[model samples]
Target: MKKITTRLATMDDIDQLADMFDAYRQFYELAPDLALSRQFIRDRMLGSESVLILAEDEEGASAGFCQLYPTFCSLAAAPIYALYDLYVRPEARKLGAGRALLLAAEAHALRNGALRLDLTTAKTNLAAQSLYTALGWQRDDIFYAYSKTLAA
Candidate 1:
């Protein structure tokens, strides 16, 4: 495993981050489109709509990335974050890059006075589940997640 350094992503990282984002979407059976991926990530990062973290290898190349969105918890009366995306390159998995990115996000959330961090993964993603569980993330038994697509 190579040494992994995690840091908040900047505009300079857009190209690599976009490539990784596209690969991530493809891993979940989505079609590949570097243009769309680039634009989406750029917009989120530039607009301050999300927190982006990038994991760099020893050579300073991007090895993985994670994106988090801020949200509020009315009941808890505190800020929270939705870790919407977490992806490590195929060659980078099990190298601790993913864990490093996750820990960085946790630290960011805590620094912002967030009370919790939440995320969801496909039901078939056992590897992700295992990683999250190993990081002390427990499965929620309280409520179900429901969504409806408003656009095509």
Candidate 2:
């Protein structure tokens, strides 16, 4: 297994991060658009509204990334984070990069005094669910997620 290192993503990592993000979106059958991906990540990084962590191998190549958004839990009166995305390159899966990215995100949440972290994965992604379960993440049994597209 290769040694994996995780760190907060920087502007220098935008190109690789964008590519990985595009792949991640496509994994859910979304259309590919590098420019849109780049701009989305750029805005998040510049606005500081979210945190993006990148996993790299010993050779300094990007292996994976996880993006988290800060949110508040009004009822709990505490901070929370929504882990919107996590992805490891096909060649990097099972090499500890994904786990490293997850751990890194958990550490960031703890460091920021967040009370909890939440995420949703596709129902068909059993492998990812296994990983989340192994990492002590509980399956949400309380509520279902709903979304509606807004007019642009």
Each model's C-alpha lDDT? Answer: 0.95, 0.95
Cα error, candidate 2, residue 57 (Å): 0.5
Cα lDDT of candidate 2 equals 0.95
**Model 1 agreement with the true structure over 55-117: per-residue lDDT tens digits:** 999999888999999999999998999999999998898899989999999999999999999
Across 1-152, the per-residue lDDT of candidate 2 in tens digits comes to: 78999999999899999999999999999899999999999999999988999999999999999999999999999999999999999999999988899899999999999999999999999999999999999998999999998995
How close is every model to the real structure, measured as TM-score? 0.97, 0.97
The regions of model 1 sitting more than 4 angstroms off are none
Instruction: Give model 2's TM-score versus the native structure.
Output: 0.97
Estimate the TM-score for candidate 1: 0.97
Runs with alpha carbons beyond 4 Å of true place in candidate 2? none
